[model samples]
Structures are given as C-alpha cells and as structure tokens.
Target: MLRPALLALFLTGATAPAFAQPPTETVPLLREIKQWVIGCDNLRNCHALSAPSGVDEEDYSSLTLHLWHQAGPQGYLRLRFDHRGEDVDLSTLLLDGKPLGLELTQDLHIELDDQGGDPEVQSFGGIEDAAARRWLQRLRNGQRLQLPGDEAAHVSLSGLSASLLLMDAVQGRLDNVTALSRPGKGAASEVAPRAPAPVLRKFTAAAPLTAEEQAGLVAAALQAVKPEEGEPEATVGALTAQQAMTVTRYDCAAYNCEFDVSSRERQAPYKETPMDLQPLPLEDAALQGSVGYDEASGTLSYFYKQRGIGDCGGGASWVFDGKRFQLSEFHRMPRCTGVGYGDWPALWTTVPAP
Candidate 1:
C-alpha cells in the first residue's frame, strides 16, 4: 500500500523546472554514465565529456573528450589529458591504428594550461561544423586512440555514442545526428538531459501537524495502495515520521517496492499515478522508491528504477520552500554493471551555493 501510494506521489507531484539558488564555481553535473559527464551553466552553455573505463586506480589516468555548445548552437570539441606525473601534451593521435595530425590552434583552438602542479590540462576547441561532425563519427567508429610513443597509452571508446547523443539533447537538436552519421546503425537516443534546477517558491503554512491532520496525511498516502500487474500479494508498512514529514513503505513483489511521502502538517500528498520512471518528458511521471525530506534544508529526494531497464536508473532532489518543490539536483546512470546493481541507492547531494 505504501509503495503504490508513494509511486503515485512521485508521478503526481512531478512538475516543471523552477528557479532555485545560484550555481557554484563549476556547473552542476546532470549525469555521469560510464565515462560520460553532462552539465551546463547559468549561461545555457552545455557540455558533454567522456573518459576511459575498466582501468585500475593506479593506472586510472584521465583522458577525456569534452564537447560543448552555447544557446545559439555554436559548438566546440576539446580533448583533455591529466595524469599524476609530468604533463603530457599530445599534438596528434592514432585512432584504431590510423595516425592523424591534430592541427591545434588552427583546426581546434587549443588551450594548454597548468592545473595546480601535476595533471596538466590541454583542451582543443574552435571546431568548424564540418570538422565537429567528422570527429564525432571517427570517435564513435574507432575503438581506441593512443599517443604516438614507444610506450603509447590507450583509451577506450566505450560509451562514446551515448555521450554524443547527450550533447544533442542538451543542444535541443534531436535529428539523430549520431545515428545518421553512421548508416545502418540503429539505437534510439539512449539518455536524455534532465530539466534544469527549478527556482524555489515560498508559502505560508501551519508550523506542525495536529492529530487529525496526521490522520488525513496517512489517508492521502493510503490511496496509492494497490496491487501491481504481476504481483498479487502486497505488504504495506506502518506510517513513520522523520524531520517534518511522514512516510509509508511497501513491498509489492520481486523487485517492485515503493514509499509514500507527506508533509507533517496539512500540505497534500503527491497524487497517486501509474507510470514507469525513466523515459523523461513523460506523458506521466513516476518514482520507484521512497520519498525523503530534510526539514532543516527543505529538500525532497528520491531514487527510482528506470523504465525497461533493471540495471540502472535515476535520482533527483528538490528544494521545498513550503509552497512548491523546485529542482535542485538530478543524476542518471543508464547502465550499472557493478555488483548489486538493483539496490544502488541514489547518492546525489545538494549544497546551496554561496
């Protein structure tokens, strides 16, 4: 009962992005899947980058391909390499055994700067439209890229396709450019960029709940208690309170579980609805787990199993200013091959910017 109720709350309470606190020195990340990291700034300039995977910690140096675009569709591509030892600046790269000379400042405006001591940073940009398209194709098709040396190091090209699609989503152009570049390759846009952090809205309400109000809150959550399609038996838990909120958890069957949420006092619980998580821009939105609230900071958070995919899903947090909830944080990992993937807790945090 609690699971279904909470499921309904996530579905019903899901709303559009709102204005929140100011951003930090670095733009907050929207997602990190395998090697890719996607995010943007207040200026609406979006970025997508990727690095190698499957390497040990000692051998886990950093080699990333970063792509960015502004609100006007003006874009650039950058490749950055950072290691613990002396800085390594690469002028050319060999991908899948094909040696290609990189025209630094000419073809791509290059930036070689010192980031503290070790871990030198070299970035390439100022790419023309033609070159950007070409590079994207090469990276996707090629298996690996290595610096020319007697002891050359290699970086994996895994997840390059998904990273490019994320770039496309951030830029608001869904022409399937990544797929179109490579004929006969068929894969839908793997992941979508999340809505921007919403601005917080304030409201006036009672300081705490009366006994009758608490009963009504429990009643609101009970509405979502129903058997899922495959599971005939359901186990609803007792209502509990934490901070200034109340919660009820339930186990439907198998991997199906949920939690419901309500403010301690009079605010209505998120409505109940049936819809799968993931597949954003949902005709209907739903969450898969318990809703958590931090009274001191006015934050609401939850994690959910992505629709159709059991291995990975998304997590999000909102700032509740008493009136309405606004987006504060979001994360999505499309594939998690790690041990115990199903119980992976959504671990995103929200620290108000100074």
Candidate 2:
C-alpha cells in the first residue's frame, strides 16, 4: 500500500521523502515568502509582512498582512494572521484538495500586539475539528512540508517537481515585481511585457534531524520549567536525558494534590536550557512537571502543561513513559519576537536510573 501510494504520488507530482524527519525553526516564515500575487493585476505586494490564509474570493487578492515571529526554547515557529481581507478566511484551514471539510475560521483565537497589559486574542469562527484533523493527518504520519514555503500547503510529499513548482512561483513573482519596480533600465524596456521565463531545477534534500539531535532539543525544553526542583529522571516525547523537573504532587492522581502551587499569578517566557530545572525557581516555569515510575520498565513518566508570559507567550505539556514518549510544546509562532509561544520541541522519554 505504501509503495503504491508513493508511486502514485510521484506520478501526480505529490512526492516527499519516505522518512521525512521533523524540522527545526531556522528561517523566518516571511523569509520563505519570496513574493506574492495580490488581486487580478498580480500586483507585487511589499512587506507582505506576514503569511495570510488563502481566501477563495474569486481571485488571488492580497489582504492586510499580519506578521508574527517568536523564539522557542531552541529555535522558533511562525504563525500569521489568516486574514485575506476583512474577515478571516476559513479556506486557510481547509485540507487542500481533500474532500474533507475544514475551516480555520471555525474557532479563531486572535492575539493583537497590544491590549493594555493583556494580549488581545479574539476567539471566534474556526475550522471544524474534523477538518483540522484531516489537514494534520499527513503531518501526524511524519511527512513534512518541503522548503521554499510556496509548495502546496500541507502537501503529502514532493521531490524535484514539487521543489521546482515552488521555486518558480517564488522566482516568477520576484521577476514580475522586479520588472514592475525597475521599470526599464533601458528607458524603453519598461513596457517589455516582462520576460516570459521559466526555470526548472531539481529539489535539494533538506537536513533531517537525528533522534539524538531531537533528544538534545527535548533536554533543552525540560530545562525551561522553572520549579524549585525537577526530576532528573523524568521523561517525555522521543528522547531522555539526565534532567530535572518539579514535583507538583507525589500522590497526585490518587491523592487530590495535597500540596498546592496556587499562590503567585502565572507569568511566562519560560526559557529552556541545558542546565537542570529548578523547582519553584524563577516563577517563570509555567508549571512544575511530575514523574511517575513504573517497575515494569524502571522508567519515569512525566506530565505537565505550562504557558509563558511577556516575551515567551505560549504553552506546552510533557508526557513520557519510559520506552515511549511525546514532548508537545505550543507557542504563538506568528508573533515571533524573542519571546514567542509554541516554540519549544519535546524530544525526551524517561529511562531507568543508572
């Protein structure tokens, strides 16, 4: 089945790597958006500022762009305003080319730059949960979006053909915009109807992170928790390390959390590091994580959900049980400043103490 699917995808120009690895935030999303075609004129827009959701408004019109970039525990992630004009388009949330019905506008949570001390997050129309799920189906399966960002949104996979299509889209737009802006260095070349050009190129392979590399990132995230003490043996996600996390409660699930950490108001920008996490350390760790050991594997499982404040504005949760683990972090990547949420990656799973 996998081989047939792979072959069919190649024939249809929808191909990616067999083992497409997880990606790291190395470049800003905007940096990948070489150029944009807005409205009927295919006008080249500047400061396209941010990535906008596609609106099926009969044409490829540009919308008021909103840009966001935030730093994560290790790198960063970018999320942009889904604005295509006035109303947020739900098509942005749709599963491209899929019959599945999904709309990003189903339940939107918008956070503006400033709203007093509190950030502004407008919660409203959003995509159907089913649609979101379908959109993420490929991702959950481990396929990654190719580089050049212009490739079909959330593609199943791709190789040279996919890469060329994206490169052409980007380069073509650039050429168009350049011709328009430069307007005839030869005085008469201004109206040369822009050169009709197309360049074909092979897709280059992107670097895939190793399990150990991902583990390092996981180890860094565990350090972000600002607790007075952390379980050095705790685990989450796919990787594990000699680490530390907080102990919110020893007998939590069965014991009603006798000890509490409800005093100080939660503030964020919880930074991760290679250093051990301190329990109740900076009041910056959104919440302390706890580990439960099972004699079955002698590995410690961890669980905790936390949100950041100020610069680091996002949240994450950790869950690990020895042999297997999952480190899921969240951040408002669109507003990616030095402080952004959903920027961290979890890569660790607990192991027996040596």
Candidate 3:
C-alpha cells in the first residue's frame, strides 16, 4: 500500500510538476541538479529523481530514475519505462559502462485496470541486496551512469553525493547503513541494528502576511541586494511568505530581478546600514533567482539562474534554528551546456555542523 502511494506522488511529477499534498510533510525542493531533483516527504523518505528534458510529458513520465531511501530495508534505486503499453524484456541494467545482472522470470507488464499501458519499473539493487549496495557506493564515488539501450547516453553523478547528504539530514543513520552495506564488504563483526528514521514534525501555518508586513519584507530585501554605490533605500516590490517563518523579497529593476529572504515576522526599522549576511562571489552576484522555505523541514532555499542558457546555475540553502541560519548545503556548476534551464554539470557539498 505504502509503496504504491509513494510511486504515485513520484510518477505524478513525471508528467507534470507536483509535490506532496497535505497530510504529507514536504521539502518543496531540497536540491536540483540538471535533470535531477531530490525531495523528501513527511515520513523522512527521500527520492533522487530525474526526467530528461525534450520529451513528451507522458513518455517522459515512464522514463525516470528514482533512488529511494528510508533509513532501513526500504531503500533502493529503480528505473521505470512506459514501453508504450507493450510487454518488454529486461535482463540487465547497465551503469557506467558496466552491466548489473537481474533475474527476470517473465516479461514485465503494467496495466492499470486494463487501461492504457503503463511503463514497467524495475529495481537495480535493493537496500539489502549486494549488487544494489555496490551500485550506491559507486554513485557516491562520483561515477557516471547510463541507461541500458543507449551506449552514448550517460548521466552525470554530480551533486548526487550532496543530495544524499541532505537526505541523511532528514532521515538518520543512512551514512551508517552505507558504510556497513558497502558492496563486497561484511557488516561490522559486532554492530547493533540502526533505529528507524525519524518522522518530520508537522507544521501548522501561521496567520497570512499583512500588507504592511509585506512592505517591511520588501524594505529588508532592498537592503540585502542594493548596490554599494550609496546608502540602502527601500524599493517597491512584492513579498510572499511560503511559510510563516519564511518570506521572500522580489523586486525587478529594469530587466534584472533580485530575491532576498527574511525570517522575522515584521520588517525591522529601515536602516541605511546593511544587515549582516555573507556576500556571494562576484561572478554569481548578477544572476536572477528566488528563495523558498520548507516549513516541515525548517530549511531555507536560495536559488539563482546563470547568465546564459544551458547548465550554469547554482543554489545555496540553510537550516534555520530560531536564532540563526546555519549553512546546510551548496552547489556549483561551471561547465554545463545545452540544458534548457541553464544549469550545468555541478558539484554539491554539505557543510559540517558546528
């Protein structure tokens, strides 16, 4: 029952953009790298997903990669293909120029109430399976992966390592399981089983932002992105709060737009002086982007688009603990091209907790 439900939410996003609805906690976008987007639900289960660009929505839905993890036996990497409503034979899955053997007793067929044929989804290696465990290790080591049919097709392993780190932050003991489950390796001679992953705390929305409250946020945003030519001044813009504690200041000057975040409920007194925040590198200062908050996970996300079309963008996000914002994760992609969204091959890194 749980498996089918999880697949529904994940597959639904394949044809169209969708997130976990109410009753299911969610981190809207924990991380996105090229075609891959990693997200988590209230249950602490995380999915590393990818759907290539330039394909029909329904056709693309069946063609996807979902690496799932839940801190225990419920972890694995699976590939799904729609097959245009036909039975298909799958003998082996190839990754990084290597073939992973699979046991297929019969042709795979996915028919929803004998309706239109759905793509058949197959697992590469399960959490407890030796081959699956090995594949995970290779992925974390930054190895490239390719689908079975296309010899020229390859998926970059960039940011996968960091995305897993974010998943571990939500769930617990994933690092431990990976270490112990290393392929061709035995578990520690004497080790206790890890406890199950923790469920995320549910969040209740606070009062909606008032017009004045929104104004204060705009003022703060101006201060964050204002050029250093003169004193910071308030600018006209709109403020939208994705969550009670999270508000984004969106303002566009000419053809350029800027987004800044604020955690306070009300805007502070207008200050000619600047607020204390880390300055982004000179090269990344001019990109257009926005910020979002995931109330369920208490994570703050900052995203930006690179100057040209292709894979050349990056993101910086933090976790807020009432008092301060701590660096949670960051990604950089300097050499990516031909990507529709302007994000290229990138590397994701996790900031060690202080």
TM-score of each: 0.42, 0.21, 0.39
Q: How far is candidate 3 from the true structure (C-alpha RMSD, Å)?
A: 12.4
Expressed as tens digits, the lDDT of each residue in 83-177 for candidate 3 is: 22223343444556676444321222332422222223232222334544454565666555555664433455556666656555444333344
- Predicted candidate 2, C-alpha RMSD: 19.7
Winner of 1 and 2 under TM-score: 1
Write the residue-wise lDDT of candidate 2 on 52-101 in tens digits: 22333322222212211111111111223322223343334323333323
lDDT of 1 by residue, 1-354 (tens): 012332222223112232121122233335555655555533334555454344455334344455544322222333333232244555556777777565432355554433332223344444655676666766787777666662334556666676655545443435423321222222223212233333345423324555565566566655555534432222221112321454556664454466655443244443333321223221224345545655556556666654333434666666654444556545554433221221132223233433
**Whole-model lDDT values for every prediction:** 0.44, 0.26, 0.41
Worst 10 residues of 1 by lDDT: 234-243
lDDT winner between candidates 1 and 2:
1
Return whichever of 1 and 3 wins on lDDT: 1
Instruction: Identify the candidate with maximal lDDT.
Output: 1
Runs in model 2 deviating more than 4 A are: 1-64, 67-246, 249-311, 322-324, 330-354
CA error at residue 85 for candidate 3, angstroms: 15
